[model samples]
Target: MRDGGETVTFDFAPMVDIVLLLLIFFFLTSSLGARQTALPLDLPRASSAVKESPALPIVSVDPAGKVYLNGEATPLTSLGARLRPLAQASGGVVGLRADENGQYGTVVEVMDVIRRAGGTRLALGTRLPAASGATP
Candidate 1:
């Protein structure tokens, strides 16, 4: 390349491709890690828990049977009304993050409230069971 009478060229196609890839990566991940409750709980293990799209509202039930709707504590009596709008907005789908140690009755009651609130699709959040003797 001669500096006196000629100019050098730069290829930006690779840079554009890399930028696009990163953009897509972040976009996909941002949606995948949708809003979740701050409470820490041990999720049950399942072999067939599938990820639902269009991220739905999260209903977290802690070990003591405390229920959180979108991270806000709400009485079970008012849960239906509180969740109705969210369920409708999310296309009648909802996510339930019940702690594995939570009482079964509480979970069932919560599910009933969810259904009464017009949630037609329920996704129970769970992780795959760890290998034997492996910390989850």
Candidate 2:
């Protein structure tokens, strides 16, 4: 014997628990993205490679000819100003990352700007290709 006025209710506790679990899972699994500017460029391969030192500041040059300093896009004229403090703070070493498709002239220009900015030590970023049959 059921009353005509009776209403049914749905339980959302389980659903909320599942949702929270999924949120936690994703939060734990998601990578902390690289701390660098979004420079869409493929780096050139190298035969001799070395591990990157974390202490150095990075400069990126994208294929579109945009320059990034410490993961932020900055004007060429202001590059020296931007880098001067960093150079003094970091003792003058600035790492350079340039795309393979990017023009050499652009890289040179960026290097020139860095030099004028008082950057003394510069390191070019590179990745070692898969080992070929040829011996080193």
Candidate 3:
């Protein structure tokens, strides 16, 4: 052997464990926030929809006419009481994310509820269409 040097090995088990724990922690915590966009709703496409603040409260309407507050299912009757404080805090600005195929009447009713809940301004959620700068 021509003056060979000793080889050293690294034990990556602890680092890997820490990385896995961090990953799980982040995943669990991230889901705890307002997840209006987390739903599988097919949003209507728009040519001009800008990003808004995340702190703005969100009201979601699924295809089945069910209502949700920040990703948690809520009934229509109690939506006002629940949304009042958030609306006031956000200066009456609330975001609405409704499924594109959802009933129009239901969406309108939900909007009414949001308005009555002290939300003076509505920020409707929409996505850009596949065709660049095209409206859907």
| Total clashes in model 2, counting residue pairs 3 or more apart in sequence or in different chains | 0
TM per prediction: 0.66, 0.65, 0.70
C-alpha lDDT of residue 20 in model 3: 100
RMSD of each: 5.2, 8.5, 5.5
Report, for every candidate in turn, its global Cα lDDT versus the true structure: 0.86, 0.80, 0.88
lDDT of 1 by residue, 29-136 (tens): 988775754788788878665664546888889999999998889899999999999999998889898898888899999999999999998888887655574654
Query: Which pairs in model 1 have colliding backbones?
Result: none
* Model 1: CA > 4 A from native: 1-34, 52-54, 129-136
| Per-residue accuracy of model 3 over 40-135 as CA lDDT, tens digit each | 888887767788678899898989999989888899999999999999999999999999999899899999999999999999999755655544
- Residue 108 local lDDT, model 3: 93
Native-structure RMSD, model 2: 8.5
Model 1 Cα RMSD, 1 decimal: 5.2
Ranking by lDDT: 3, 1, 2
Model 3: lowest-lDDT 10 consecutive positions: 127-136
- The top-ranked prediction according to lDDT is 3
Please count the clashing residue pairs in each candidate, in the order shown.
0, 0, 0
